[model samples]
Target: MISGSIVALVTPMNADGGVDWAALERLLELHIEAGTGAIGAVGTTGESATLSVPEHCEVIKFCVDSVAGRIPIMAGTGANATREAIELTRAAADAGADCCLLVTPYYNRPTQRGLYAHFRAVADAVDVPQILYNVPGRTAVDMDNEVVAELATHRNIVGIKDATGDRERGRDLIARCGDEIAVYSGDDPTAMDLMLAGGKGNISVTANVAPRQMAQLCALATAGDREGASAINELLTPLNSALFLEANPIPVKWAMAQQGLIGEGIRLPLIVLDEQYHADVRAALEAAGV
Candidate 1:
């Protein structure tokens, strides 16, 4: 089962608008040291939409190569086009990623039947494990529990990253799907609660900054130690709210640069975290003792 604090990592960039492979290597080392359970490349947190197709494949390949075999690399290979998703998933598998995370088709906003067909097609195309990503906030489309349960029956459709943050829905999914589908929380704020109520773990944004804490929180929560997990989660509440002060990688990339994890360069169309939100993000970092 895919479990524990899986980090939705940010793609590092250089000043001249190129992928900073060296910085990415360092970030991988950091996560490994911090005990991140798994790593995701080219997800929303990794600024996948903005990256060119070649860049996307390169990032996945780089992550897979850099990590070698330390931890499972779950490549974000989702695309609005089924063909594109299949192409990327095949590349990820060939590049050595252990699994693929496929988000529902955005912009196009397919129906539940379309969603099932898209995922099923990708699973059929690739032999590796596939994890469905359902983040309606960004995609503007939600995959209902029934659809997920149906998809879970596929041999390669192994799990899901539930970003909806609806505990009731998540609980219902767990009760219904049980061992068939491994449900992971994609929303960091409610990750502890979800895990306590039987989620597998979190595919987290918070893990970018507080990897050790996030991993520990997931560990504690997964072990059914609600008290311990809650204590650590409180320390991360500020970070959870702050990193999202801007879109995603904007604040997260800024926070990582503050700690010298990456350079201070974000691609165009997406700028640095606004100056106005600096104090709040910094304060949160301090509060979390990062």
Candidate 2:
């Protein structure tokens, strides 16, 4: 299993909303140098919803080529449409991505059977290893544990990024499907606890800003070192909460820009972080020593 902190990277953009290729390359190098286990290119944090199909595939290919097999690349290939999901997954595989993360169909609110069929169809169509993403708060469709366990039986379905943030439910999912597939925490604040409960790793947004620290925390937590992990998690908890202050990349992008990692560019429907939360976020970053 690909373990440790897998950064859900942000797609750096120019002020004109164009993908900043230079910044993207720098960010990739940043994660690799920081010892991030993998890079989740074009995932939610990467603004998968906004990128065009060609851009999405191009980003994945860019990451794969830039990394040069140094570490695994988990491409975000999920879509609300089954055909699009399959096409994206195929594109990622062709781009030589190590794996793909497919979020549940958003706005579709697929039933359990529909969810199973949707994921299965993609897994069957593409040969790449697939990781299921369950973030109902964003997608509005929840994949039940029983349904997830059923899908885990597929040879190509290697893992699930459970972003539910409910430790009890996460523990139950681990017990139910841990034997069949690796479980990864997609929720940052509760990530350490989930890892200590046998989660393989974390698909994290926090790593976008504090890659080195998040990587260290994941290593400690997954290795069963509660004290070491707790120390880091406690420090990161505030930043983790702060990042979600206005939904995902909004805050994380601002945080990254503050550190001079990227520019102040966010796509439409999602503007820059509010000035009101600036002090609080900056304080959190300072507290976490980012």
Candidate 3:
């Protein structure tokens, strides 16, 4: 199980929207130096929706090559199309990703049965370990724990990133399938509580900016050090909230740019962070000591 703060890495881009390879190398070095447990390349925060298929594969391959087996790489291989997901998963595995993160099919609301079949098909088609991602807020399709439990039984279906933020539901899921599969927290604000409740780790957005701090928090929390973890979480609380001020990556990318980590570049339909929220995010970064 790839544990601790696994950054849902952003694909740094040039001002004209081209992938910035050099900047990406810098960011990878940032996480590696921070002792980040893993990297989620081309995931949501990486703007998976916007990247072309070839581009997506390229990014994953780049990450795998750059990391050089130093840490696990969970490539974002989910797609609304089952075939596409399978292809991406295959590509990630071929590229040497340690695992694949498959989000529930979005926009097309599949029934529980459909969801099961969709995920199962991918898992069956790909031999690599797969982690299910349930973010109803983004997918519009809520995967019930029962569905997750059923999926967990697959030897290749090794984990789930539960972003529901419902602690009770998370606890229930953990009780039902923690022994079968690892459950990771995708919601940053509630991540600590989930980890303390037995979540394996966090697939985090905040880590994009504060990798060292988030890594520390995850280590403390997973070690059952509530006080130590909470102290770090408290410092990061504002950053966790601020990053989502406008859809992900928008605020987070801006924060990283402000820190001179990446340039100001994002794809269409998703613009740069608004000026109104700049102060809020900045204050949050300062408060978090980022």
The per-model lDDT (C-alpha) reads 0.92, 0.95, 0.96
Clashing pairs in 1: none
Q: Give the alpha carbon lDDT tens digit for every residue of 1-290 in model 1.
A: 66899999999998877889999999999999999999988999898999998899999999988899999999999999999999999999999999999999999999999999999999998999999999999998899999999989999988999999888988988887868978899999888988998998999998998999999999999999989999999999999999988898899999999988999888888998899999998999999989
Estimate, for each residue in 47-125, the C-alpha lDDT of model 3 and write its tens digit: 9999999999999999999999999999999999999999999999999999999999999999999999999999999
The per-prediction tally of clashing pairs is 0, 0, 0
Scored against the true structure, residue 55 in model 3 reaches a CA lDDT of 100
Ranking by lDDT: 3, 2, 1
Candidate 2 lDDT, 203-262, residue by residue in tens: 999999899999999999999999999999999999999999998899999999999999
Assess every candidate by TM-score: 0.98, 0.99, 0.99
Global lDDT of model 2 = 0.95
Cα deviation at 177, candidate 1, in Å, is: 0.9
